[model samples]
Target: MSRSIEYGNLMHDAMRGLIRKVLQDVADHGLPGAHHFFITFDTGHPDAELADWLSDRYPDEMTVVVQHWYDNLEVTDDGFSITLNFGDAPEPLYIPYDAIKTFVDPSVEFGLRFETQDSDAEDDEAEDPAAPAHLPAVKPKGKKLKPDETKSTSDKEDEAGVKDAEIVSLDSFRK
Candidate 1:
C-alpha cells in the first residue's frame, strides 16, 4: 500500500489559518488603511448561523462585506461572529471558518476560494482512506472583480515592479 500526501486538504487548512490570522489582526487593530473584505460562505453549513431572512435570501451561499460599519467582531478557534447593519436593522451572525467558501479583499484584488466536496464522495473517502480525492470544478460567484477599478496606492506601487494582484485557486495545486 502506497501512502500519498493530501496536499489539497493541507493547503485548504493553511489558507483557512491565514484567514483566521488576518481576521484576528483586524479585530485587534481595526482594518488598516483601505483594507476590507468580502467573505462568502455556505449558509447551509451546519455550523453557520445567520438571520432566517438572510439564509432565505442567499439560500446556499452568501457574501458579506466587512468594512465601514460593523460590530461585535469576535474570533475564536472555530469561527467568528459579527453584527452587520442591514437597512438600519443590525443582524448578528456566526460564521464557522469551515463554512467559508470564499474570502476576498477587493481593495487588493486578492481572493481565496474553497471547493466543496460532495457528501457521498467524502463518505467514500472516509471508508477507504487510500482513495484519491477528486477536485471539483468550482465556479466562483458574486461581484466580478475589476483590478483596474480597484487599484489603490499599493497597486500603483506595482509600477515600481511590484507583482500584480491575483486570485489563487487551490485546484491549480492539484496533481
Candidate 2:
C-alpha cells in the first residue's frame, strides 16, 4: 500500500480570502470596538511603496498600525492606501496585496500568513535559517517599535509586564 499527501494550493488561496474578508469588515463597519490591525509586509515586494524617504530608511520591511488617527483609508484591487501620521508628518503609503507577509488582530487572536515570492531565483538558491524569523516588516520611524523592541519603561510597568497576545504562525492552516 502507498499513501501520499497532496500539497494543493487551496490553503494558500483560502488564507488570502480570509484576510480580505477581515479587511472588508473593517472597511465596512469602521473597526468595530477595539479591533485594529497590525499588518506587516515586504516593502520591497514588487507592488509596494513607502514615501521615497521611508523606503530609503527602511529597506527591508515595514509594519503599520490601523487604529486611531488614520485617514483616507481606501482599499483597492491591488492593495490598500491610507494616510498615517509619522510624528508630525502625515504620510501616505500604498501597499500591494501580494506583499503582505502577516496580518494579525491581537484583540481576536486571528491572523494570516503569506509566502514571500522571490523575483529572482538565481540570485539566491536557499533561505537563511540562522537569520531572525520573519514577522511582518515594520518601519523604523513608526510609532510602534520593531517586534524585538519593548515599549517604554513606564508603559511596561503599567501593564505589570504582561506579554501582549500575538499570532506566531499560520503554518497549521497549510496542508
Candidate 3:
C-alpha cells in the first residue's frame, strides 16, 4: 500500500487535552505551593478574548503569568477564562486553545512549546468585540494628496526598498 495516514493532527489534539486536564485540575483545586502557569498566545488571533488595548500593545504575541492572584479560572474544551490584574483593576481574559503557543510551569520546570499556526484573522475580524481595536487615526479612503503634500525627499524611498527596485511595465509583458 502506498497511501499513508497523517497522525500529526491526532497527536496535536491529544496534547491539547493534556493542557485542558491540567487547567481543569487547577480550577478544581487551588494552585499548589510555588505552582503557577506561564501561558503565551497570539494576541492578534481573532478568537483571543482580551482587551483591545492589550492586543494592540502586544500585537503579535503575549505571555500572561497566572500565579497567586488569578481568579475564576475556568477551562472548557475550546478555551479557558480567568480574571487577572491589569493596571489597578481586574480584567478577564479568554484564550482559545489554538491561540496558545507556549505553556510552562517554571516551578516544576515543565514546558511545552507549540508551533505557531497561520493566522486566520481578516482585517475586520481583528477588531475585538468587547473593546474596539486601538488604531492610529487615519484619513478617509480615496483622498488624494496634493503635489505639495507628497514626499519630495528619498528618505521614504530607501526605507520602502523602492530605491533599488527596477520599474516594471505590464505593457511590455502583454506584447
Error of 2 at 124 (Å): 19
Runs in model 2 lying further than 4 Å from the true structure:
1-8, 117-175
Q: Which ten residues in a row are the worst by lDDT in model 1? A: 148-157
**Per-model lDDT:** 0.68, 0.59, 0.61
lDDT of 2 by residue, 1-175 (tens): 8965433235555665666776666777788887777677777887786787556545666667777767777786668888876554678988777777667676665666665446465245443322323443332322455556422101121143432222233233223
Give every collision pair in model 2.
62-137, 62-138, 63-137, 63-138
Estimated TM-score for each candidate = 0.67, 0.62, 0.63
Q: List the residue pairs that clash in candidate 3.
A: none
lDDT (10s digit) by residue, model 1, range 88-155? 56789999999987777766656777775564666544422222333223333232344332211111
- In candidate 3, how many Å is residue 153 off? 39
**Top-scoring candidate (TM-score):** 1
RMSD in Å for model 1: 11.8
Per-residue lDDT, model 1, residue 30, is 96
Off by over 4 Å in 1: 118-175
Using TM-score as the measure, what is the rank order of every candidate, best first?
1, 3, 2
